[model samples]
Target: MLRKAEDVLTTTDVRRRQVDERIRRLESRLVREHDEVPPSLVHEWIERASARFGDARVRDFVPLLVERAVRASVLGFSSDQHEMSGTWLPDWARNTARRLLADELPRRWAHTAGVARRARQVARVLPVEERDLLVAAAWVHDIGYAAELADTGLHSLDGARYLLRAGLSRRVCGLVAHHSGASAVAELTGMAEGLAEFGDERGRLRDALWYADMTTSPDGHPTTVEERLAEIRRRRGPDDPVVRALAINGDERLAAVRRIHRLLRRTYKPARG
Candidate 1:
């Protein structure tokens, strides 16, 4: 009689081998589709996707589902990276930020998403390359608050350092390092030296991030600068270091916002007869 498929190998082992083969095929297809993406990066995404299903109770279709997710992620990374170099924040990066903040600090995640939305609204005013950068910065601007990265108690420096280690672009690292006048906080907290390594990426890119951050409230709603400032003070307390830094840098931050708003108004002309 012909041997059954499971006679040679246990059913579980066979299933495992099938999943592995599927993953390999998916990886090959991804490489073909996004030939420009570094092989290492592609593999990293595959590894991450595989890891996510490691503890799952079910096995059937998991590999296929993971492949679909990986494909979407790879396509997003490739498209954005090609358009903006280091400015494109991959799903991995965004997921890392969310994983760090979403459960531990849901409010922060809301604020981050709001800032990203604001970035999207103003994307037309920025160059194509900068649009992705601003959005990436918006998404991860508060990663320092994540418990894993709260070493210095200075989110800006900590977040920037983490991103730099993750092999993100210098501009994105610098923007995260010094976002929304974080330099002023660094000065107050005596972490200026640590932040200096990332340098001040001040300019339109920095200004855009600052505008996106300052105009969004803790609840993730768009608000005027005055209201946002009040919310910060209310949330952090008047004696908080962040509040002190805001007090010191309030004028400069507000000025940056006004400058960006003016640019938007000047560049955006309403359609008319």
Candidate 2:
């Protein structure tokens, strides 16, 4: 029995080291492929994978499964495709976000679509690059709310982390990371540090998304900021953490909404004879 116990311990130690080495190799490969992805993000992904497989009975395949799962979550394109530069959100991102949320959260799907529509409406007021980035952010802003992606229950951070892992542009990740007064809620959740890495997107783009998200109701209809805040309070209740946080930061959020509206009025001009 003593000899058998020693053998078991030896096997376990070797497997643990192997898993560590594999994760290191995976991190190196991800860095090579995604130069913009922060090392901290890569480490977080590996840690999450390790925790997920810690108790599995199949020790031999844990490393392989971890690699596959991490790659699937973070990589959305082939090597050649990643090398190309473009402004538009890829079809795969839209499809992936839709697949993750459409069946499980139909209301969210509708709201995302509505936000995308708002992004489109603002296209004429923004530069080409900004327009595309805003549209991309709108399409995937709420993806963190998807069941499969809600690791921290802070959709902005979760969605941004997933996108960063998938090798999306850092700007899009940043926008998703800090959208819709997420920083206020992040403070309440102890996730503000993780979200700080992405930084904030440009002011115009950030405010554009803020307007898109705040103006649209959960049911996907247009509404004023007052109505939207009321709706959120109604849905989440007075005692909810998000409600409390929003109340504390309501002035800042309302200011952003008003700023975007003013920007829209200044920039948008109707075509006339």
Candidate 3:
């Protein structure tokens, strides 16, 4: 998972030690059950799981949460040191996004579903191996808006940080970080330095994600890019940095949408089994 040990919340030394001991015990039990799995790998999973809940206000149940997360990582799907893979990604993304956004941000959930719908529709434009990446990124691109994960207040970067730490594919995190002309917004907001951690990923994958996000409305309906831009300007007002960034990059974003539409027109096909 993404590394930054210092980012975990500060805790009393006694509580930290107790949590460490409980995780150690959990690792031992896992080692006994899956003797084939390396102890170091098990330990790494525990650490990553623990890091994820570092900011939780209630610390007493953190060990249990870590155990559940580690078990899911180990037994629920085929994953690697820092990437989730296989046919499980889209389903996992949907479930996770629902868990994070359904109750707290219903409107955003609708938007996420709309983006996922658009992604599935356009996935055919991508290679077979890459289709899932687009759809999965679509589902969780707005996750940083979740109350539990909104550390930076910049949704794109905060969401990408959580995705990377949670062991999603780097490509998925990159798409979320740079989606819908986020780089321009980040620059205008003075968050470019923080957002740069994900590295810039361009080309078809990024464009496809932008197409999905830019064409979807806050309430999750399909719309023209111009209409979406108008809505954002209205909601944020003329002086908002996001509106300013859009003013600067609006034409480029429209060009990307048009290019995606042309690709879909030329080679539109439903996703295949």
Which one is best on lDDT?
A: 3
Rank candidates, lDDT, best first. Answer: 3, 1, 2
TM-score of each: 0.66, 0.65, 0.66
Any idea how many clashes model 1 has?
0
Which residue ranges in model 3 land beyond 4 Å of their true spot?
1-86, 269-273
**Each model's lDDT:** 0.76, 0.73, 0.77
- What lDDT would candidate 1 get against the real structure? 0.76
User: 49-116, model 1: which lDDT tens digit per residue?
Assistant: 78777656777676776777666765554444223434436456578778899999999999887777
Please write out the lDDT profile of model 3 over residues 109-227, one tens digit for every residue. 99999889777766656777888898899999999999999987789999999999999877788889988888898988889999988866878877888888887779876665767
Candidate 3 residue 171 Cα shift, in angstroms, is: 1.3
Q: Model 2 over residues 41-149: C-alpha lDDT tens digits?
A: 3445666777788788976677777666666544531221212125446456668778888899999998887777666655445666677777788889999998888
| Candidate 2: clashing pairs of residues | 74-165, 74-166
User: Is 2 or 3 the stronger prediction by lDDT?
Assistant: 3
Q: Which residue segments of model 1 deviate by more than 4 Å?
A: 1-90, 271-273
The weakest ten consecutive residues by lDDT in model 2 span 76-85
